[model samples]
Target: MDDYEAIRSGILETFERAVDAAGRDGAEATRRSLAEARDILAADRLRPVVLGEFKAGKSSLLNALLDDTGEPPLLPEAEEIATSVAASVSYGDQETIEILRDTDDGTPGLRVDRRGLREHGTEHGNPENRRGVLSVHIRTPSPLLRPGLTLVDTPGLGGPYLGHNAATLAALPGADAVMLVLDSSQPVLRSHLETVRRAASAVSATDTPGALFFVLTKTDLGGYGEVLADTRAKLAGALGRPAAEITVVPVSARAHRDFLAHGDEEDRAAGNLAGLTDALWAALCHRGVPRVLGGALDSLDRGVRALLAPLEGQTEALEDGTRRTVGELRRRALEHQARLAELRKGRAQRRVALRRRIDTVQEELRRDAEERHARIWDRFESHYLEEDAYLTDPQRLVAQLTADAAQVVGEINARAGTATAAVLVRTAAETGLAMGSSRPTEMAAPTSGDLVVRGRLGEKHRSGRLKRRLRDLSFGGSMGTTTGALIGSVVPGLGTAVGAAVGGLVGMAAGWASAGRDLRNEDRRLDRSSLRTQLQPLKRRQAAHISASVKDICEEFREQAEQEMEERIEQEREANQRLVAALKDTEDLTTATAGTRLAELRERTRPLQELRTRTAELEARTQAFTAAAVDRTAGGGAAGARKPEPVTVPGAAGDISWAEDRT
Candidate 1:
């Protein structure tokens, strides 16, 4: 661990030097890339999340893992469940729990305590969570959680609350590892299996497999061994891997709770908590830290190499021009011209690659927009048909749809922009390396802030006499001219059977023409058909608009990247031209002066040589760390089966102990 930190610090210091070098050379793109990579390295942590179905002992599992045994599980649990808010627990010097909630004032976040957490975040007091609870953060002093390990307790999936499922899914992609908790009494509930599958898929999609494990809770119940075996067999079969490949840590939270209550060594041992704790400690210090550190090192190596490329190349060029004669100057000029030609050729090839990449990004945006819109429409249709109570708030439907549209737009922009930006960064590096010059600015692709659907659709169109008559007919002649006028363009009548579909009102002017009074039987059928007809065109229009706008935005983003690359290439060409001109102007010189100038150039290049050596060392260390992490990942699951060796911290006097009682 100390070795990793030392290497990390050394790389970061070298990265800062590279950034400064790039900046001095006016290499804006390279500097930005280095800065971003530095921030990523500096902010990284080992995040292992606990996920499962509601009341599957997720909170209890977290408490036990953290060695917290207060009554009712240190984290909140529910007898009568409601909303499931996620909670993040980590090690701190002093114990503290804070609820992240919204307030009337437009501040960043609000912090509350255990009672506030129970009232606002738990399923009991604020089951609806109308106050908009974001997450509950808890900190405790536990040796097991040292050196920046964050344990997340996410809301249960496959439950009645869809919001909880969404929250869990949203947070899954960022988890370093997943600990899926299951109820042993229920033989691996389908929901638990589904959660595991999702975690596996998510981690696999990110190309990080073997990052998921299982924990069966309530092992104190009858048939614990049977449930564990059944779970292991099912998981192996489902995942298409060997049973031994999957780690299953069975423990009764109740036993740990009891042990905490009584402080009995036998009870703690009986709970089988020590085994899981040892496994987790092994995973955390060995597998998790290396992965995080290795990724940071990889980024650092890439950034530093790119930053130093121009200086290295220029140093090589200067050393090659050490002869002091007209022929030597002519030869240097010819070489400069040849290098410039090569740079131009490379730039042209990179431009073609950039264009192809942007084309892929554009296609992705179009497909994503269509699929997202279709999914939102499906949900709206389901809710509108199945839940009559949902019809009470037309404004809520509009808000929901609007939010969905915004999310789709935001995601599309973010993904496409990131792809485009990466291409630009690579192009910048290639151009800089070719030109023997450097740059450090980032060309950020434009976002979808202006491209997304905004403002209420109701305000776009107005209705007059035709709307009033349709309102009167649909409302059984109860709405007079005055009420119709007051209702305005949107929501022309209260009881018009518009039913709050798709932005509160859809073609109120055409309702009566398509339906008779009472809107029953065949008339109701015609009314539904007409509403679909009217809404279908509008939906298609919105969808088409979003698609076109996204395409345009993607085009603009691609164009910006192309422009930045072209500018860099131009600058490089100009700089090369000046260097060739200087060589031509200096046609003849004495050997002594030439040798002195060459000596000065060599001195200037010394830092570049040093940087090259430093980067090589960085790469070597990064590869070592990455290879170690891979080995640990391959054998981490089975680390528990063998009698564990005492793992010692670098500076600490005592070995890290998982069996030590925290209570």
Candidate 2:
């Protein structure tokens, strides 16, 4: 490889590295763009290659380069896959001059995916192949491409018509030479001259200066030279220069190769491939081949990548949003202190009702117990006599009294249970604890509290440990043996004191048994301290769980946002760099950027597009007015003049007549 080719390789390596370290979608796009730029750079480094259009002897030219004419020359005979867009190629065809023309005022546009040529069977004046695309590739054993020289074959200039030929002409920024192919039968048309001039201008302004020339095909037809001369003269008149500024050489590509080599006089032609190659080489050597297209290609790759970066970043952001991940986590702890305060108001009302119910129940129970006791006392009083008492077995008496007392206590307990449940239920109603289907719960654990003693009468009845002795009748021995001794030992006050002491002890034990049972039941009821113990673990567990989930959600959101942001920033950076490089490179390689041109174009088009729109509106209005004034079928008014250049694409960057609006 030459020094320039080596440099191209180095530049391509740099772009590869950029691709690897891109780190984001936009960056990746830029890197790939750079890769394509490598192709352009490589093209610049190569010897002049040609743009080969289809059905324009492209295949024959390509095959001849290696001097292999084995296959029958047929246009588009065995095409590859359907390539919808036009493609580029290199040819060493000397005699063929292919230049582009613009259909819109015969001017071309700057498109991206099109070449300025079409195949033989393709539509004429097709804009499908527009812009800076190369349309043909040819291989030739022609002497024209002997040294660092190449031939380019284009579709019929005006016929191919990728808009205007300006783009095809401008593409010379990467070329060292050009050839304009013409038909031997045609005249030197105005559009043809324009193509020659434009191509020359493009070459003059590029790395290689003035690398343009033309050729005429089908030379057998008469008047070819005369027409060429006439066109040259016309161009000189307009440009005020020698016609040699834009070279126009005529030849038949196959004349020598097919005519003399093959003895078929009618079929053989002129403009041999060998001769064509020699002519092309001459054109390129006229100016040293430019060796600077590498940079322009690289610049294009970078620019395309940059343009796509923002879109990639936005996609990343959208993905992050789907996960609901963000950053920063804080919990606002709001204590339900107000709800507790409200509870106090309810507690006060409940406390009053509870005390009243307790008093009423206690009074009622006391009255009922006293009245029953009195009835039992009256029966006992009637049964008692001076000598009626008798000794009985201890077991029999104990059993009888225990059974009667158990029955009566069981009855009382049943009544008390009903009364207590009713009172407690009422008290609970006044408290919010009992609201909305809620049940009053135990207030404390294990029902811990002192048993309250209230209005129950203390009754002392008699009895002692009797062994057929304490309640014994002393009628037999009462007179003789104990008259003097009884008087002395059983003094009245002493006997009474002993009996009363025994009765009091018995009453105390019985009272404790009954009261302890009721106290046990009440203690097993409501208790706040107990409820606290059960709820503590459950409430805490619930709160902790919810708090953790909230934290997890927030953490995920933050992480995703950060990831997307970083990716976006990286993409944006690469995009910006590519854009800057592209713009800079364009300015360096060309006359100027569209920056100033766009504004100038808009200024030029403003009046024309506006005028067109206004004319359209006015025309419609006049038609409507005429219709309204007509007596149902009156004749229309005089015909109107055509509207001035309405909605036209801008031309010359400032021509009002050329201004056009796309929308």
Candidate 3:
């Protein structure tokens, strides 16, 4: 355990108590938030995945890390996808291997894997992972494992397993850290660099910093020094990070294995494996844990603030008394209601106009998306298909095509997101007119959820079978987008809260990337013409699906907007009635209970005030933990030219024995 993890553990314990107290106080929302906070902090593992091109020694690096005690490598290493299956190695009381496979009912089940992993999880047996093997869990006694660290071995990118690309990309955001392994003997290609950028971009979008590391593997092969320098230079040019801040380390997994087995200092010195191990442990202790803890703290703080709001509002209402007569208030309500009725009539006419205009917008969006596909495919044919070698090599063809397809989907999703926002802005203008306001402002600043809608779409599709019934779909009904759910409880006001709801619809229309998965490699030997001929049907089907889905989503948004308008009007009417009644009854109540309501409100808020104060203290601790972790990593105490110090585990009496890098 790192200091951050220890602090998080303390926070979790305190938050659990807070949940109990809140439940007792009947603060249901605060209790729910605190319970969620407990869940987030209960998991102790840091999942730092190893990702890269096929045959980059990713598995070997992970095996070396897992077998640090001179044990045999736990994972099978081969040059094919047959040995890759997104294996995660963690600590266990008893050594065990659990294979998580999807059942016929589509839910995952764990089966003991005593024989081998290849039969259930390899590409040859479960090709394209279509056999339903989700993940492999390996348990070991390595001291590194004692800190609750899980090393994930992802399938190689740009391999024959196209689905692996989607799976890996989807998993990137949840990773505590990512190690992008590269073959140091070769120059870093554009694709490899792009892989790093994508991972960094995803992490940064979530506001998590320093989650990416570059690993230059196969150092024993020689001539890697020049390659390492060049790769760093390119990364600096590409990512705009200070070269010093970007941690790129070199290692040889074979040499590390040799050193561990025989205690060969020469092998250890040559591989620098000890240095890599220390760096990894230090990062887990110093960077990963603090960042995660900080995020959780931010979430908890927001929940507490939300709880405090209503109490404060009620207290303030009691303090002020600009009471108006009940009759006057009722008249004002009727005037507002009449204006709302006129607005509704205007909205109905506008809806008809917008509905007609929507078809034109959809057609324009579809045309734009198809043109993007045409451009990408044109490039693919001109560059890749023109080469006889690309056609002959199945792996090469599959990898290139998979990359091209994902790129096209990503680009189209972006365009669709933009177009969807435009449709929404146009639709909202009518609502704005009804409310006697100017043009509506934009929704909450677009989260990564807005830009990468397909990521969420793919997650939703993978979680269940999305039936074709538009009304039955969550997006089609009232659930709104993922962005909407995040704000549904926190933000107040009709326009502000539901603006996020409308944004969710925009996300759904734009981010439907699950369709790209329909492209497969049943027969990988097809030439360019045959491939294009084969894909034409999928393209046509996908285009039609997009059109229908977008249509349904837009229709749903219109309904939600109308429903929101009505709900807002009703809320205003009801609130005014309550105010009128309160004013009419106030004279009698003041004689009997002056200041009584204010006293009760203050008493009710005492516990909440205490929780808020405690939350502030936890926030300070979270910041301190982050700052301390950053300082440790920055001073060459973690990873740099100097031999990295062994990261001390929290809650331990002394250091476990892998303190010095034998290198």
lDDT per residue as tens, model 3, 254-371:
8988888788999988777656765564444334664445445544554454445445544555566434343454456456556656766676676676666556655775676567
Off by over 4 Å in 1: 1-10, 20-33, 44-47, 67-74, 78-85, 88-103, 136-151, 159-162, 220-223, 240-245, 251-299, 306-356, 365-615, 626-663
Q: Judge candidate 1 at residue 143 and give its lDDT.
A: 60
Clashing pairs in 1: 27-438, 27-439, 27-440, 28-439, 28-440, 28-441, 29-440, 29-441, 30-440, 31-440
Top model number, TM-score: 1
lDDT tens digits, residue span 1-663, model 2: 132233334445544544444433335644554455555544442334333222333433433433433333312222321122222433344323243333456443332212222331234333343433334333343432332234332333333233222223323434555655555566556556655554444344332333444455555545566766765566555444565443444455455445545766553434444344444443443332212331233243333334433233322323233222111000000112233345444545544555566456545544543443243233223321111110112122222222222222222333333344455345334332211111111111011012222212132221331222222222222322334344434666645445444444444444445455544443322222232243334333333432333334333433432332233334344454543443333333322433443344345334434433443343334233222322111111111111111321111111121111111
TM-score of each model, in listed order? 0.60, 0.28, 0.56
Ranking under TM-score, best-scoring first? Answer: 1, 3, 2
Pairs clashing within candidate 3: 1-650
Order candidates by lDDT, high to low.
Answer: 1, 3, 2
Instruction: Evaluate model 1: give its TM-score.
Output: 0.60
lDDT of 1 by residue, 1-663 (tens): 344456667767877876786677565765675676667666666788778877787777677767875544567775635354667888789878776666777763656666666677666678667777767787888765655678887777655554465456555545666677788877666545655766675455333345566777887876777777888888877777678667777777778878888988867865767766544543343335544554444444444454444434444444565435445545664675676577667766776776787677678767866886787678667544233332333333343444345445544543454455455546545554322111112212112222232222332233454565566555533333334444544554553333333213333434565453433343334433433443454456557766777667666766666665554445344444544554543335355555665576567557756865786676567445444543453454432222223221110111112111110
Query: lDDT for model 2, on a 0 to 1 scale?
Result: 0.36
Number of clashes in every candidate structure? 10, 61, 1
What's the lDDT for residue 8 in model 1?
Answer: 67
Better of 1 and 2 by TM-score: 1
Which of the predicted structures, 1 or 2, would earn the higher lDDT when compared with the native? 1
Question: Candidate 2, which segments miss by more than 4 Å at Cα?
Answer: 1-86, 90-152, 160-170, 207-209, 235-240, 244-246, 257-275, 286-663
